[model samples]
Target chain A: MKGAEIFVQSLLREGVDTIFGHPGGAILPINDALYDSPIRHILTRHEQGAVHMAEGYARATGRPGVVLVTSGPGGTNVVTGLTNAFMDSTPIVVFTGQVPTPVIGNDAFQEADIVGITRSCTKHNYLVKDVRDLARIIKEAFYIARTGRPGPVLVDIPKDVSMSECEFVYPESVHLRGYKPTIVGHAGQIRRAAEMIAQAQRPVIYAGGGVIHAGASEELRTLAELTVIPVTCTLMGLGGFPGVHELWLGMLGMHGTVAANMAMNDADLVIAIGARFDDRVTGNLEEFCVGAKFIHIDIDPSSIGKNVRVDLPIVGDAKHCLQRLLQELRSIDKDWKAAHADWLAQIAAWQAKYPLRYHQEPEGELLPQFVCEQIYEVTQGEAIITTEVGQHQMWAAQYYHFMRPRQFITSGGLGTMGFGFPAAIGAQVAYPDALVIDIAGDGSFQMTMQELATAVQYDLPVIVAILNNHSLGMVRQWQQFFYGGRYADSSLEVSPDYVKLAEAFGAVGLRATRPEEVRPVLEKAIRLRRPTVIDFVVKTDENVFPMIPAGGSIKDMLLA
Target chain B: MPTANDEIQRHIFGLLVENKVGVLGRITGLFSARGFNIDCLSVAETEDPTVSRITLVTAGDSRILEQVQKQLNKLIDVIKVMDLSEEPHIARELVLIKVNAGAETREEVFRIASIFRGKIVDVTPKTYTLEVTGDEDKIRAVINLLKPLGIREMVRTGTIAIARGQRVL
Candidate 1:
């Protein structure tokens, strides 16, 4: 069998049914093999779009997303996507075409040192020098990508190697001597953590994206309920705990709710499950949870004390740790509910006093928050929400109440603009019948607007709700607060009509200029069950409030 | 030993890694990417042909050093990382120094090299090439003593360390 045939077989062996990629001259052999294979390939408009789509597919389903692209420019374009996935710990395997093995270092046409280029941004990468190593490399790439903390891995295959002949034998298992992930928590550490939790007067369960990645939402919810502890999620962890639960504290970060931030500030113990203390969550590290003892549980050992010091560190899978913790807590005879009543009441008081709020008059211009609320209502909080990075993303997080894990898929760590539309398309590909919506900002949407053709071509019924404010709302908001209202280059005064663009791409387009029209347009888009773009002309100066300035303590939140 | 203050101290990290192309690049790339400085680095294949040993020297506060160790361990190509500085360890570095020693300075250079237990590797009428192996401090002292004798050319291998006990890195 040829090396390209072996590559296809290895993917099949790994249970990869769909791939997101683009074609070019260097990858012609692999493309030829793909033509005869059963694996479905979603050809993206650009290499970046392909990788983002793979991320969306991987996030929606708990499988490693896969991508294939050509050499040089194709390889360079996916670097941002690889970095984005790496930062978020998304599992994606990217295969880039390389110049023939003989000309690898000679700088042949469309050649690149992609493996070296992506060394830091990827979890691991490989340059297959021989056809004999192709199968094993693919196996290792997938293993490295989906295991442990889960991150993007790349495999650059030379063009000649793919064209060369090799015997196809897929490995049954991968044995990486240097790569071993601790799946189960240490028994003694789990016991100590349980004791700490039981003894604390005020405790908050801080969850992050790792919970969703580990499929530990059920375990997390059980532990929280059994201990009667309040739960707060990071932006990436929005749906890990049910949004409508009484114990749920809206996301705790820069734009976090007052109750969640205050609770974090006052807690005596913080049980951080699969959550890193990112700077956005813990502003001014000196003042962040200084009074609290921390118990950090994560699969990545390096992430435990990377940012903030912790009292106890449990290195293992979040699900296994949570399971053991719940068992240990159950063995103890403590009335957690009665002991934490005062703390719960205090949290309730904070929540009641200050909620996530925005103003909209009876006939005022459409607000982005209002549009988000309408999306939530129309989809009944069931849509898979992907967002580009900006004010609209924050609004969606504030307004759309996610009921389950994997429902709120957005670029959290890298905060990549132009991520949502392609990601939504990927999610739609994974679940054809489900409503996958991209709540995008105009500035971010324009970054990857060309993917509209991909969506239309695939007939993916994904809705792009563009919060069309004339300026970059988030940057403008920061400038207003810090730079004495100097907007500078943050304005998008001249922009394309999103509706016309959608129509030109053979997709439906709708416009909602007023608050009343927002719901109707969303309902119509949902009814159409096709690729549709809804242009929501929102308030130009609208800002995401309840924001603690960058590096500011939680006490310094600007509520108005 | 407990640190009296959070002063920056030199640390030696011994790492066993897969002897593959780009593995070294990955390790060095990590340090550069994280804004950490590498004071000295030496790598060579170990007894196991498939594996290589790397001795890296860096200086930082304890907290930052701890992070560096963890980050190094996180790399996929690295099999194991040992902080040789934290344990009783033997470290050595080889230095070859060529001194401009005519008849007048030759005797003094020979005495200095003998005092430092260095060997005369090469000699000419005007130059004496001496080879020395010792810890970083001894090498620094020898270089300092030979500076006034008009050193012509010098090359030094970075430090390589191993734990003194039966434990292997």
Candidate 2:
């Protein structure tokens, strides 16, 4: 059998049902092999779109997303997506085609050193020089991508290797001597953590994307309820705990709620489960949680003390560690609710005093917050929400009450614009009947608007809800406060009519200019049951409040 | 006895890694990407053909040093990382120095080389190439003594370290 045939066979063995990619000259052999295979291929408008779609698929399904692109430009286009996945710890395997082996160094047409280019951004990468190593390399790539701290991996295959014939032998299991992940927590550390939790008078649970990645939401919820600890999530951590739970403190970061930030500031102990203390979350590291003793639980040992020092660090899978922690906590005969009564009351007071608020008159210009609220209302908080990076993204996080893991997928770490549309398309492909909405900004939507064609071609019923503010809202907000309001190059005044663009792509388009029209347009779009774009003309200068200035203490927030 | 986290110190590390293509690049790339300073680095194939040993010298505060070790271990190509500086370890580096040892300076240079137990690898009408091996301090001392004699050129291998006891890395 041919090496390309072996590649397909290996993917089948890995249980890859769908792949996202764009074909080019160097990958012709693999594309030909794919013609006879049963694997579904969603041809994206660009390689970057393909990779983002793969990430969406991976995040939604808890499986590694797959991408196959050709050489040079195709390979380079996926670099942004790879970095995004690497930063967010998304599992994606990208296969880029190389020029024939003989002309690899001679710079033949469309040849690229993609492996070298993506070395720093990818978790791991390979350049397969021989057909014999093709099967094994694919197996290893998939293994490295989906295990440990999940991340993006790339495998570059020379065109000749795909053409060369070989006997296909898919390995049963991968054995990487250098790669071993600790899945079980140390017994002694778990016991110590439990004791610390029981002894603390005021404690807060800070969760991040790692909780969702490890599928530890149920364990985290059980532990939180058992101890009556207030749970706060990062932007990437939304939906890891029920948004409507009594102890939920919204998100805890730059634009976090007043209750969450205050709880973090005043707590005596902080239980960080599968969360990295990112700079966005821990403003002014010198002053962040200065009075709190920390217990950090994560699968990656390196992430434990990378930012803030921790008293106890548990290195294991979040699910396994939380299970052991629950067992240890259950063995104790303490009344956690009684002990934490005062602390809970203090948090409740804070929440009641300064809740998430925005003003909307009876007949005022449509607000982005109002649009997000209507989206939540129309979907009944059940829609899978993806967002581009900006003020609109924060509004969605604030207004949409996500109640399950993998429901709120957004670019948190990398903050890549134009990530939502493709990601929503990927999620829609995974669950065709489910409602997947991309709450996008006008500027961000324009970044990858070409993916509309891809959605139409596949008939994916995904909604692109564009908050058409006619400016890069986040940068504008920053300039308004810090840069003397010099909005240079931040205005998207010469933007295309999104409705026309959607119609050109053979999808339905709707417009909601007034606040009252927001719900009706969303309702109509959902009823269309196909690719629909809603142009929500919103307040141009709206800013996300309760924000701590970069490098400022969380206690000092600009709340208006 | 540096007690504070801000006290910067030099540390020698021994790493066992896979003997595969781009393994060295991966290690060095990680160092550069993470902004960890590498004082010196050396690598060679070990007794096991499938594995290679790397000796890296770096200077950082306690926190930075801990992060360096942890980050190095996180790489897929690195098998194990040992901080040789934490234990009783022997470290050596080889240096080849060519000195302009014409008539008057020749005897002094030769005497200095002899005191350091260095071998005269090459000799010409006006130059002598001396080979020396020692720890960093000894290498620095020898170089300092030979500096006044108009040293022509020099090259030195980075440090390689191993534990003194039965423990192996």
Every candidate's CA RMSD? 1.3, 1.3
- Which tens-of-lDDT digit does each residue in A1-560 have in candidate 2? 89889999999999999999999998989988998899999999999999999999998998999999999999999999999999999999999999998998898888878988899999999999999999999999999999999999999998999999988888888988889999999999999999999999999999999999999999989999999999999999999999999989999889999999999999999999888999999999988998999999999989988888889999999999999999999999998889999999999999999999999876988889989999999999999999999999999999999999999989999999999999999999888999999999999999998999999999999999999999999999999999999998899989999899899999999999998898889999999899999999999998998899999986679997
**Candidate lDDT (C-alpha), each:** 0.93, 0.94
lDDT of 1 by residue, A170-266 (tens): 8888888889999999999999999999999999999999999999999999998999999999999999999999899899989999999999999
Candidate 2 accuracy as lDDT: 0.94
DockQ of each: 0.54, 0.55
Count backbone clashes in candidate 1: 0
Docking class of 1: medium
Give the DockQ of candidate 2. Answer: 0.55
In model 2, pairs of residues that clash are none
Model 1 misplacement above 4 A: B1-5
